[model samples]
Target: MHISRQQTESAERGPRARTRKLMLETATRLMQSGVTPSVSEVAEAAEVSRATAYRYFPSQAALVHAVVDEALGPILDWKADVPDARARVGDLIKTAMPRIDEFEATFKAALKLSLDQWAQRQAGTLGSEPQFTRGHRVELLRDAIAPLTGTVPNDARERLVQALSLVFGIEVLVVLKDIWGLTSERAQSVAEWAAAALVDATIREAGNGA
Candidate 1:
């Protein structure tokens, strides 16, 4: 009997997929307990060998990235079918802000990892750790502004995306709740207002050729 390529690939992927899922779930559980656990720690907790764990996550950063991605799965998959740019952006904010609040601790841990890696890199001590790249907000913002493709200049749309990012994630939570002493409800309201204002401003500027 001849084995097809699809069958071979699927067979190969089965164990790898299960292993990756196990590691991710183990890491998430550990992180939820209020500490950024190392890969070895997660492996130990998950009852998987260190060698197997390292194969899936080469570093703590890589492991945290996967956990954060899993935590953000819902927002990353959100979509708005409205035609108005402002409405689309508002829908995104409304959908995302609550999830961010719900997963505040996870996001904070991820942010800490990002900052720690940054500091290590600046000190030339970052060794072989994979950098925790952050671009989910960029993609989300782009989708939020997709309705303005023809109306707003590409450059202006880019600017709008950039501006909206500032008010989108945990940073907004920190700024509004921690620094400004706003309640969660108030902070979310402000973020939504700022997002809508930025969208309107970008459209106006684009029309004015600015």
Candidate 2:
């Protein structure tokens, strides 16, 4: 049976939309279940033909990357309204901890894929770190720690920046969560406690005998 051009276009559009939705849904399921399913498995779970899945997502890697970003979007969005730098840093982590914990497997997979890409790249084509780029996490930490340093001697600003960078940085997140196996909530709580303590100590030291 021959289909009209309009019918063909409509059919194509419906399947394309459904395929995209299926891809995202399947990826989220994989993340929740801690399953590293292949494209074929995802297609089967999504109830789409393998070719249909490939049409929406060119490759499994692309699908996985999109899913991870989607999962992190709400966490990033919540941090936008935070005005206090110190609170923002702590709040950002606290807010993300539960969501991050749930989607931890997805982000971990994405990181592994990114590392593999870096390894395959040429010298000039080397990739940068995706998890720790310029964003709310970095900016918020910088702001929160800035006021902790009072009008000290020269290079005080630089010192505070370096200290905060070392303490509440993205690398800390990876270490606390991945290496130490600390729950996201616990890690954020510890980090916030440390940041608050540093601020208090700085003020106390500056007011010594004054």
Candidate 3:
């Protein structure tokens, strides 16, 4: 019974992939419950040895990033398919808004951890933990508005993206749903409308300049 090299590698990778997935799922559950767990804590929860978990995630930052990525699921692969920035931005928001209901808890937990780290850094008590930087929307928004080269002036492009960013992501839910008591559907509608309005405003500003 001789196994090819590719087959041998697959057999070994199978177990490692499953173990990493289990750890991610366990960490996601803890995060959804409003706890930003460390690597060792997740290992304990997943019933894996600390050494094995460390082999997968070297630090808490790595563990949190993976958990958030899992929560994001398909969102990280979104691409703009239309030449119209307005349509692309609207589509992106609608696509992401649906996931808000499913991953709201995880998003909030991540936000809490970010705040904790920020405070620690401000007070100069932060340890060696690498900063958990989060700004995925910056790049996504830039991609979403890439088609605005003609519709939006270059000077106004970044500002438009920044304005639209304010209305994207979990912050939309935190404002419209949590504060204003809007349903998820209503919140999504608001986001889409806001995005369209920004694009329109940018176009108008460009026209005025031209």
Candidate 4:
């Protein structure tokens, strides 16, 4: 019986993939529960050795980043199906807001880590820790507004992107839930409305040559 090289490679990769998945799932659960656990802590919770967890995630930032990717799974790949820029932006908001609400805790933890890194950098103690960078929205939002590139003024396109960013993420949760005490459904409706309104207002402002 001949086991092909591909088969051999797949067999070798199987355990590594499973280990990585297990660690990631554990970390996601931890962050979802509102605990920004370190790798070693995740190992304990996952019943894996510290050495194993460290091998998978070298630092807390890495672990948190993994959790974020998992939380943002489908949203990260979102694309507009419609041709209309307004409709596309609206569609993107409708698609992403629910996941943002579902993984609310995970995103909150990621935001806190981002803030912590900024403060640490300012205090000159950031050291060699890998920065928990976050600007995916820049690309995602820009892509969502791709249809508006030449139709709207360049600055207006950018202004729409910037304005849309304000309605897209954890900040929505903070405003609608923490501040306004709205439930997730209501929060989502408000986000959807705000996103549509922003797109409409930006286009109208551009049309008026403002």
Candidate 5:
């Protein structure tokens, strides 16, 4: 009897994994389709019971975060092999921009969730929902600028990271493509140029102690 119970538990694990994957994939498709769906909406779209979906993702924030993480899997896996800080930053921008473009809607939906949470929190209506904080760009920018540590002061490194964040994500896409009406290639080129220029200027300023 105990052996049968153990086998049943093992057998149940596969379906649980499949259910979670289905929920994530469904959420991604919805977000990519330009709808920032709630967990229940995703569950309905996935043909999953709302209860089951909630078991996997308890709230809208959790669901949106999972979708964002899925879309960012490629960028998260990126590694810079060269040691030059400027070259590394350029490489990261080149690698990231294309993927960022590919997942633009997903990232934007994630941003919307963040903004909504911020507004709710400010109004003291945020309740018990988990907060969705954005930090991927912070870590990625720091890594891209890691080779600058010996030459640039820690504070300056942080400032460079802050500056690069301006051009690093879907917000840049909106500024460059939507507002400026630049082509995708042009937008990417501009961002890469800006990133490299920031690295050079930051290093130069540090050298002069300015």
Candidate 6:
């Protein structure tokens, strides 16, 4: 009886793994082309049965969320060696800017839904956790800054971090690319410049009269 059960579990595991792979591959291909492929289409493309696809991901949103999580693997691991504080911050911004642009459309769509969810929560209509939160992003930014600053004062560190947040926001990208009509490369250049300026401005502010 034990041997039979083990064989059955192993059989199920193989199919499950294959289904997961297919779903991910299909979704990524569709999203790369600026289309949100439906579950049936994904299953057809992947040559998996519809039932198998649904078993792996019950809904399109679930598949999309999984794809986003998988796609962010490298960006989520944003740690690199640099020679100095200025270079460290600049390198970090440069590393992140292009990654952010890749998922800009997807993020813009999802964030709109999230904003609506926040409004519902504020009106006492939501009965669940917050839908949109940047607290984690803010914390990560602080962690990245901590190692770069050699001897910045507490106030200066706080000021510099706030400036980093503002300069690194998606709004900056939108303004530079959309309003100003700059190319993506040019916009990123502006963002990097702004981030560098913040670092320099904070250092000067901290040094004045000291």
Candidate 5, superposed: residue stretches over 4 Å from native: 1-13
Backbone collision tally, model 2: 0
Which window of 10 residues has the lowest lDDT sum in candidate 5?
A: 1-10
Candidate 2, superposed: residue stretches over 4 Å from native: 1-17, 35-41, 79-83, 122-174, 181-184, 194-210
Candidate 2 residue lDDT tens string, 70-104: 77656645534444445655665566666666676
Model 5 lDDT tens row, 92-207: 88988998899898988888888988999999999999998777888888999998888899999999999999988999998999899998899999999999999999999998
- What digit string (tens of lDDT, one per residue) describes model 4 on residues 181-201? 999989888888888888888
Deviation in angstroms for 163 in model 3?
A: 1.0
Residue 155 in model 4: shift from native, Å?
Answer: 2.0
Against the unseen true structure, what C-alpha lDDT does each candidate score? 0.85, 0.60, 0.85, 0.84, 0.87, 0.67
- Give the candidate number with the greatest lDDT: 5
lDDT of 6 at 95: 72
Candidate 3 runs further than 4 Å off: 1-13
RMSD of each: 5.2, 9.5, 5.7, 5.7, 6.3, 7.6
Give the candidate order by descending TM-score: 5, 3, 4, 1, 6, 2
Q: Give lDDT: candidate 5, residue 126.
A: 94
Model 3, range 51-165, lDDT digits (tens) per residue?
9999989988878877776777657768877988888998899778888668999988888888899999999988998888787788789999998776666779999888998
Better of 1 and 5 by TM-score: 5
Of 2 and 6, the candidate ranking higher by TM-score: 6
RMSD of 6: 7.6
Residue 119 accuracy (lDDT) in model 6: 86
